[model samples]
Target: MVSREIRASVHWGVAHALPTVFLRRAAAQGDLQARLIRVGSRGTDEVFDLVEEIRARGPLYRSRIGYVATSHAAVRHLLTSDDFRTGLPTDQGPIGRVARWAAPTTLHPVEPPSLLVTEPPDHTRYRRLVTRVFTMRAVERLRARTGEIAADLLDRLETRASGPVDLVEAYCAQLPVTVIAEILGVPEAERARVLEFGSGAAPSLDLGLGYRRYRSVTRALAQFDDWLGGHLDRLRHDPGDHLLGQLVAVRDEGEGLSETELKATAGLVLAAGFETTVNLLGNGIALLRDHPDERARVVADPALWPNVVEETLRLDPPVLLTGRMAVRDTELAGQPVRAGSMVTAILGGANRDPEVFDDPVSFDVGRANARDHIAFSAGRHHCLGAQLARMEGEVGLRAVWDRFPDLRLETGARRRETRILRGFERLPATLRP
Candidate 1:
């Protein structure tokens, strides 16, 4: 149980504050317990305590509002159910409190809309367009390319293999960017700029930053629009057989994507397809190095690739969380949520939900229900690049294992500063050649 004072403090001071500050305090306090909880003014402090409790106890636990907000019935209503649709509390303003506060540009201030942001029609439309190129069949075409990229990266790692190499920078991060760049027909020179802009634009999803983040993202979007527009123009005049060319040729319902929509769609595809997969590969490799037994199993039996990928996703998802606005005044679990409130679906937390997974903390590649995890999410907003991501992981891991059968993590591992994309900034590994 959490202390009442702490609960009250978090409820009053933390709920409405900037999430960065809130998470900072929470991290500093080292009190991240509770599962599937809400924190707001009034009784929201309890949510923080609950989060801490969940962290403390295991992966899953119940949450309750502070003493003042609701009855025992209301508390029960919020918990003991999976109807996340209703549990979110509603906003009470014109712009909608969440929209005002949780601007995408403010939280990350960098990075782009990589499937985590955007809702409904826009999300659906963009997802549909990219889905055509990112399909399992389409991604299969990249198998040879992905293998070549992995082999080239490994070759580079071996050549410059002095001291401790950051596996992330050397291999994981580079692989996806290279692959996606080729796929999207982005010029080699512009790849670095595209990555920088995408990364800078990602943090805007945190609801606390709101308009501030949006402004920054808009600027980045403008740059991406300009750069990609020129790229598209070149592709139009001299069409290549790449994914972007296909996108340009696509006409849905006799209505092709507008110039702005095409750019936005391209931005989304590149950002999501490249960044998240890079992080996933990076994180998965790190985890393998950390857990030797798992690595040995993967090396011995490449057949376990799918399960290994699922377990990796379960333990460390690339996209930690996603946001959605309520379409209607609905009840989630048992909470009263008004229409248009912001909801942060904790994909990381949800994947580790004990009720859904056994021994959630442990890394078991062979876990029976591992595939049921929501690393790709559910419903209309599932990742369009899911198949592509899986293929990348399998190819990357297989190539690494086949090339260097005795790879192990060096003494030190450093993670990236960004929390939204969970992976290594640098993972020093020794390849036994």
Candidate 2:
């Protein structure tokens, strides 16, 4: 599990980095909010402990400012239920004391809505536009290209092996960023610029980020928005098969997709596409190091690489928690929820529910029920990049094994400071000397 000390330099989720919500409203901010909300800051293991306690109480339990769903049954229900919506509650209501922080007056690049935030008619429309393009079929087409990218990155990584290497930074983090950049048709020269935005602008999604991080996020978003505007203009005149070109063509088609949606969606793809997959690779690699028995299995068969990926996802998901708001008065597991209520779905807890997964904490590569885990969340807002992420994980992990079959984690491996979506900032590894 990753730590919750994430700064702007490590991970940021664009629109999701921060929000005016029932849950995070009480969370500690960097002097951004006048009142502080106590969301029980804890390390990874402790957080999981709390999740177990909460789930044991019942499917739905009251949290700092809202309800937290712990059971897999409850979480799946809330996620798939039309009663719960994607958007957060804008009004502070009873929690206004901790919710009244004034963010930057400047226009944020992450706003004007993306698929990650909007609900109903808007989500329906925007989702339809990209559904066919982002489907498993579409993502599968990139498998060969992703493998090539993974191979090249692994080549550079292996050559740099003077001693122990930070696999997370060198290999895991680099592959997805490069792949997403190319897929977006970001010019080779401008790829770094996209990376700058993707890496720097993520804290905007975390309401708990201190004022320092918040201010940094504000600046990053402004810069990202400005550059993206120019990038879109260049693509408008000369479209390609890249996602940007496809979106630009959609804009020209005059059917749907607003400029705001285009910019937000693009930012979402860059930040989200890069960050979550980084953690997946990091966590998966770390798991292999800890579970050499499973490692040996994959090392022998190689055919079990996909199984390794699935089990890794089950044991240690990239995204630990997500939010959903009640669109109308409803009951979850017999707990009454008001029309405008919110729930923090403890995904980490759900994945480990004894009811769903036996010995859920144990990392088993051959676990038959591994795919049943909702590491990607479920229902309407399921991760759009799930298939693509799986492909990258398989390709990325296999490359590591192929290049360094004797690879093992170095002593000083470090998890990222992110609480919501767990990952690593520095995961050192070395082939046995």
Name the top TM-score candidate. 2
Q: Whole-model Cα lDDT per candidate?
A: 0.61, 0.74
lDDT string for model 2 (1-433, tens) is 4343333223333223444343354434422111212232222455676666677668887754578887888889989999997655754453332232333323343234677767768877777766675688888888899889888887787677668888876788888888888888788788767666756765555555655666676688778878888889999998888877988898889856788788777777767787889889989988898888888888788888888888888778887778888988999978899988888787887889899888899998888888888889898889888887898999998888788878878787766555676777688887644
Stretch of 10 with least lDDT, candidate 1: 65-74
Candidate of highest lDDT: 2
lDDT of model number 2:
0.74
RMSD of 1: 8.9
Kindly report which residue stretches of model 2 are placed more than 4 angstroms away from their true locations once superposed.
Answer: 1-43, 90-112
Tens-digit per-residue lDDT, 1-433, candidate 1? 7564444334223323444455446445543421222232112223434433554543222222111111212222222223333222333453235433433221121222333445446656767766778778888988898988899889977776555567776777778888889988888898888877766565433333334453565467557666777888888776688878877776322465765566667767787777788778877887776788887787687788888888989878876644444555766434556565544455666666666678877888778888866778666556778998998998887787677777778866765444345666567777762
Global fold similarity of model 1 (TM-score)? 0.74
